[model samples]
Target: MKILVCIKQVPDMESRFRPNGEKTWYDESDLAFRMNEYDEYAVEQAVQLKEQLGGEPEITVLSIGPERTVEAIKKALAMGGDRAVHIRDDRYYQKDPWQIASMIASYAKGEGFDLIFTGMQSQDRGSAQVGVIVAELLGVSCATTLVGFSYDGGTITVKRELEGGIKGVAKLKLPALVTCQLGLNTPRYPTLPNIMKAKKKEIASLTAAELTGEAELTATAAIYPPAKKGGGLVLEGEIGAQVDRLMGILKEKTAVLR
Candidate 1:
């Protein structure tokens, strides 16, 4: 089976984020980066599936980002991916979900992949929409937050985690998309030997325009995050007096009443 897993490089969760000069996104100067945590589960799942199937599955990790993303992809390789494709686009920093999905779908459309795996969401954006969008674009079956999976003869069965003590299971044909959830498996650490081998693995790079054959972004702008504010407190008073005082404050501040 040929498995394709989508991965992402995001700011290290430990960093303290602050807004750039603009008020739309965070400044990244002091931040470090790591692979998206959930995508790591997806990678581990693909590797385990290949082992159980008794065939050398060609597992390819795909990412859309800047040069730093190579480090993240290498981490996957160190764990157990056959190769990687890095869509090295500077504009990837500001891409919305639609554009990101479009690029991945465009590249994966005819790759003869038996299964496509992705994380539930990216750590940086947390927009849990890419896998569904990519599945829609490819016109394939999709299962999200899959915790367990097994294959029989030619059909693949998946177990998904859901809310309120509900879990879902389904079977699908060769070509399918699945987004993995946490607790699917404990990801193994990369041994020193595997890390050395991973460094030698080839990481192929492609441009966004090259992949899409046309420039898709309208224009790239400097992104920044919103400002922080101090917390407010409610003062103690009698219930009736508090009600009257709150109404007066609202009226004075908002001009709700003259």
Candidate 2:
């Protein structure tokens, strides 16, 4: 079996982020980057499937970003990905979901992969659109928010969570794509030996020009953080009066408060 896992390198959420002077993107100076938290789950699922398949399933991790993105790919290799492919373009951030998905689909078109996996959403933009778009572009079956997965011969069964704790199960034919959410499986960490071995693994590099020619679907007009939240109200009165005021506030917030 062959599996293709799409991973992304994102700015660490813990970093102090401030828009650059142009108000386009964060000032990346001295910022540390890592594989996106959500995508890590996808990588873990791919590696786990490969290990379970027992017949040396081919797993290739793919990503799009600048040259530094190779570090994130290396992390996936240490976790057991067979190899990696990097789509190098310093302006990846400027591209929209359609453009990004088009680039991935372009490379994936000729590659005969049985399955493709990606994070449900990216941490930075939280667009949650690339995986589905890729699936559509590739003209394959697609599933999202996958929590349960199993493979049998040429078909795979997957379960996804719906609202109100409902689970949806479906059987997808081969050459399908899925966007994995958390809680599917506990992601394993890389060991010292695996980290050393990852250095020797293959990481094929490519450029955006070599992939596809698609214009960005959306443009960022400006960027700003949310405004500061309002301070809480203090009820200064006797117990009975405070209770009455609290009831009024709750009533305004919710109809059941009455």
TM per candidate comes to: 0.82, 0.87
Which residue pairs overlap in candidate 2's backbone?
none
Regions of candidate 1 where Cα sits further than 4 Å from its true position: 213-258
* lDDT (10s digit) by residue, model 1, range 135-206: 999998888888887777667888999998588989988788989888878888889999999998888888
Candidate 2: where are CA atoms >4 Å away?
233-258
Span of 10 residues, lowest total lDDT, candidate 1: 213-222
Query: Which numbered prediction scores highest in TM-score against the true structure?
Result: 2
Over the full model, what C-alpha lDDT does candidate 1 score relative to the true structure? 0.85
Model 2 per-residue lDDT tens digits across residues 1-258: 878999999999998888878787777787999999878999999998888888478899999999889999999999999989999999888888899999999999999888999999999988999999999999999999998988888788999989998999999998899999889888889999999999999999999999878887798888887786876897896999999999999999988866
